[model samples]
Target chain A: MSKGNATKLLGAATLGLMVAALFMVFVYAPAEATQGDVQRIFYFHVPLAWVAFAAFAITAVAGLFYLWLGYPVFDQLAYAAAEAGVVFCTLVLVTGSLWARPIWGTWWTWDSRLTSTFILWLLYVGYLALRAALADGEQGARMGAVFGLVAAADVPVVVVSVRLWRTIHPAVLVTREGSHGLADARMVATLLVSMVAVTAVFGWLLALRVATLRAEARLRGLAAELLALERASEEN
Target chain B: MRAMAAVLLKDVVVELRGPMTTTALATVSLLVLVVLVFAFGPVWGQSEPTAAAGALWVALVVSGTLGGGRVVAVERERRCIDALVLSPLDRGGLFVAKSAAAFVFILVAEGFSLIVALLFFNLAADAALARTAAVLALGAVGFAGLVTLVGAVGGRAKGRDFLVPLLAVPLYVPALIAGVKASADALGGARLGEIALWLKVLLSCDAIFVAAGLLLFEQVVAGSE
Candidate 1:
């Protein structure tokens, strides 16, 4: 009923779902005929990609809300999404890299998906870093909101450019496309389950982060008030 | 129109008068080319058009980051950004004007870099230079457009020199990839139509970046006070 109770319930539910998803990923998802167990990473990897994009989309939507309403709550929402988005984006790159090493035989490549994901990672990593560097006030929030918008806008452009770039340069290997992953019903089921589970994880992280930021803001406000009271008492 | 021109004109006049930023940009660009010399060492010669294209664009990107980061820095330093922000001109106009000026300045620096490349790389001299120029110009516009926004955002944020480039350069990735390939095609004397796709991609990048800066610049410059 209470807000705290609701968060705890959500947290416990997501944690359970994620544990089940992990089981599905490692056990339920049958290994590919070609790539073997290495192909199993796809279950988690695809969901990470999905959730990261979703998180970034949240940042953009929340930022627009902040801009239109001049509300700090929306800004806080954007900040939470941006921070979580960066973490997921980093995992996407790392998972993609790990997947690539076993399959593509390289640590990294300029493939369309990987390239766009990398660019997305860089933009938001910078966003979080920039927010940290700014004065923790309305100015920081406003600037961060703008950065969120810019990063969101670039996602499509990066995808298109990377696709074009990939076409110009031959695709060395096609993995994780419709041909392989979708054909197997178990793999498909595993992927679907993981996507739901990972999304729940995203929601959990976002809510927790937003709450933490709010508490920090409150602490800062209380500190300022305490200082003011001290100054007033000294004068009296 | 008058206000936009004034912003552009002031940037040009200041750069022409002092040439400090240009000098710094030129020096860094030249240094990058020198590093390319190591890349294209004994086996690779100046006649390598592909290598030349790669080197030229990397040099351009490096210099552009350093130069472009200063777009808002100069304004912030003189506290002229406050003046610009307070001006009656719409934020979109200011963004367009600032981008135009930065684009032209980058082009100038790239032109000088081209000349230096000609001497160092012994690049192809014929019809390809024209296409290379086109690719460079389009790429510069796109690069400047996005970087100016980054500069504004980063400059206004707390003191982090690397922040703008880190944030902006990734966005610049699409343009850079398109430009490098297009430039390489041009240097190879590939037909205009052969490179048409790259040109189109570059144009779209330029358009999107300009539109983005125009639309979002107000948000970036608007004070939260």
Candidate 2:
């Protein structure tokens, strides 16, 4: 259907799924025997992290396409995805911190996964800062695309190296071994639903942001066209 | 191959004639080392080898950022990039040449930093020093590739000097981690076999950066009318 209808449908789906996911997290999923209520954060935390990674992946792919095809839409999509990715990534870190404070007795640790996630956040911030520094133009788009691709390429390496670094250096705090051993099926169901819910939420937000960016680009194009027309008329 | 060599030789000849970039790189790294010594001097007894390795890498990265951009920025200042772009040379070949030049500069700078670290940290000049140099060389390969491409990417932008570090630093994390660990192990009297995994990580990081630089450099520096 139309773009607006698709967005509305996405918004409705996201709202429904989010509400269901919340209910499942709070009322359906049973708490862990050891960690108690704080364990419940896993449902949201894992999904947020998943969506954040997915969003960044989308940004990289969009950037790749923009670089290859020189399409403005791809550039816009990349920018929007990067923006959404950063927001979700931040939420993942904040939620992780909140959970850590209660469960690990510290707000943060230099664990492998945690350290890589922080690096991922920094990569996103760096991408955004570069984009902000350069005004909207062909050069900026190309630069941003190149940066996104390079950043995405480094993710696996970052994960591997950080994990290696952590293993070599003795951990300051003891992390839960086998962190995701969902003994209860309800917990699985909740996690799966939460994943879908967060994905939908990300989709809705991405669509809205892309639409706004497209409109802005169009306005800029029209303004440039108007200036050209005025200049031509004055010369005549 | 000839075009790449020509570009590489041009950069080398220019730097050799007036070694401003190399001198600046060495000085910046030296200053960074001195600053690190002051900061970590009090805790020297805690982890001397680790502190030395960490300080050296920090200097490498900070100076690497400063030197990396000069490769492209110099060409830009002389308005030579456009001529080079218009030349018949392959863009990928050009990438190889520029990164190779950057590699040489960063290696020189790292070498100076190593000597300074030796003095500041009071580490013995022995086999461990040799191993540390080897690790620094590997780290420089990856860093040279990264900082070169990032420099070109940021070259056309406003405040690109700031953009270079902002974009390269995070991308350089894996290298930093692997480099620091390998160097620390080397300095701590560990065998090459012990830090083989980290060295492999550095090599892989180098491959990724160089390969990506080859693929993306054209788009990043494609001059527009």
Best by TM-score: 2
Docking class of 1: medium
**How far is A132's C-alpha from truth in model 1 (Å)?**
1.5
TM-score of every candidate: 0.93, 0.95
Superposed by TM-score, candidate 2 places the C-alpha of residue A214 at a distance from the truth, in angstroms, of 1.4
Worst 10 residues of 1 chain B by lDDT: B39-48
Candidate 2 chain B lowest-lDDT run of ten = B216-225
Q: What value does the lDDT take at residue B147 in candidate 1? A: 83
- B50-96, model 2: which lDDT tens digit per residue? 99999999999999998877898899888899888887888899899
Specify the poorest-scoring 10-residue window by lDDT in model 2 chain A: A171-180
> What docking tier does model 2 reach?
medium
Q: Report clash pairs, candidate 2.
A: none
**Candidate 1 structure quality by residue, lDDT tens digits, B124-206:** 56789777877888899888988898888888666657887788788878788888899988998888799888888788888
